[model samples]
Target: MDAAALTLHDMTAADVDEVAAIESRVQSFPWTRKNFADGLAAGYRGWVVRRMGAMLGFALVMDAPDMAHLLVIGVRPDAQRQGVGERLLRRCIDHCRQAGLPALTLEVRPSNERAIAFYRRHGFAQVGLRRGYYPATQGREDAWIMTLALAADAA
Candidate 1:
């Protein structure tokens, strides 16, 4: 897909429903509409990727003086592996860089090898572990805490 074909926009209240729907479709443990709304109400920064007026993916990040936390991100099931998610992630990194944040952090399920690999490809590294950080079918799942340092000269 042409990179220019995708457009990024700041997420708003009106986008919560659609974003939540996409989240539900793409995640086994999805965030509800209320979750997205509350995040927005709490002043979390959000970005949505669209192609020809169709929602493809979205990312929510919480900014801080030291670092930015990627609270959650999701892409439409049909849009996976088409560079839509990568575009959204780049937006997040750009936001952090523009804010002068030195790093970005996120937690991922240990079982999600695909996502782990994806983050690794994007310059993220495993930094720590959070035990039983997520609810799983059997009991709980450990989370891999990943960090991406934003170097002064990084692109």
Candidate 2:
């Protein structure tokens, strides 16, 4: 896909089917359709990236009083290294700053080295750990709690 063709738009119910499909393919345990429905019903800020009218990636974020939680971010497998994930993440970070949210936090599976490194390169730091945060075939897996402090000017 050509990078120049990419566009971002607010996620809608019409986009959830494709988003959920990508999520299932990219994640070990994906969020169900109802989960995305509930997220939308709760008014979470969600967005999707597309190229040629096809969904390439999506992000879901929630804002609290002083902080924002990056609930989920996923890129289609074919779009993984084509800058789609970074684009979504940067947009999410930018939105957090614009919302005056001091920080953005997310929990990532410890085994997701690529995601961890990607987040690190974007200035996210591991602040804590959640034991057995994910269900595994053999047992539960721990999750790393990472946070990024957004610079107000960066918005």
Candidate 3:
């Protein structure tokens, strides 16, 4: 897909249902519709990606005192590996930089090697681990905490 063909817009209340639906389809442990609504209500920075008026993905970020936290970033299953995620992530990084944040942080399932590789390729690094950070079909799962520091001279 051509990256230039995509459009991104700030997330709003009207987009909660569709964003949650996409989240449910893409994530095993998806955020509920209420979760998306509440995040928007709380003034989290969120965005929706569309192509030719079709929803392709969404991302939500929370601001911390010193950094931004990526709460969710999901791409439609059909859009995976097609650069939608990369564009969305670049937007997140840009947003953080515009906010003067020093870094961006997120936690991913340790089992999600593909996501880990994606983050690494985008300059994120494994910073720590959180025990029992997520529920699993069998038991709780560990989370890999990853961070991307935005240095003045860094990309």
- State the C-alpha lDDT per candidate: 0.94, 0.91, 0.93
* Per-prediction CA RMSD (Å): 1.0, 1.2, 1.1
Candidate 2 deviant stretches above 4 angstroms: 151-154
Cα lDDT tens digits, model 1, 54-150, are 9999999999889999999999988899999899899999998888898999999989999999999999999999999998889999999999999
Q: In lDDT terms, how accurate is model 3?
A: 0.93
Write down the RMSD of candidate 1 (Cα, Å).
1.0
TM-score of every prediction relative to native = 0.96, 0.96, 0.97
Order of the predicted models by lDDT, top scorer first: 1, 3, 2
User: Model 1: which ten-residue window has the lowest total lDDT?
Assistant: 146-155
Error of 3 at 59 (Å): 0.5
lDDT, candidate 3, 1-155, per-residue tens: 99899999999998998899999998889999999999999999999999998899999999998999999999999999988899889999999988889999999998999999999999899999999999999889999999999966354
Residue 117, candidate 2: alpha-carbon lDDT: 96
Total clashes in model 3, counting residue pairs 3 or more apart in sequence or in different chains? 0
lDDT of 1 at 129: 100
Q: Give the local distance difference test score of model 2.
A: 0.91
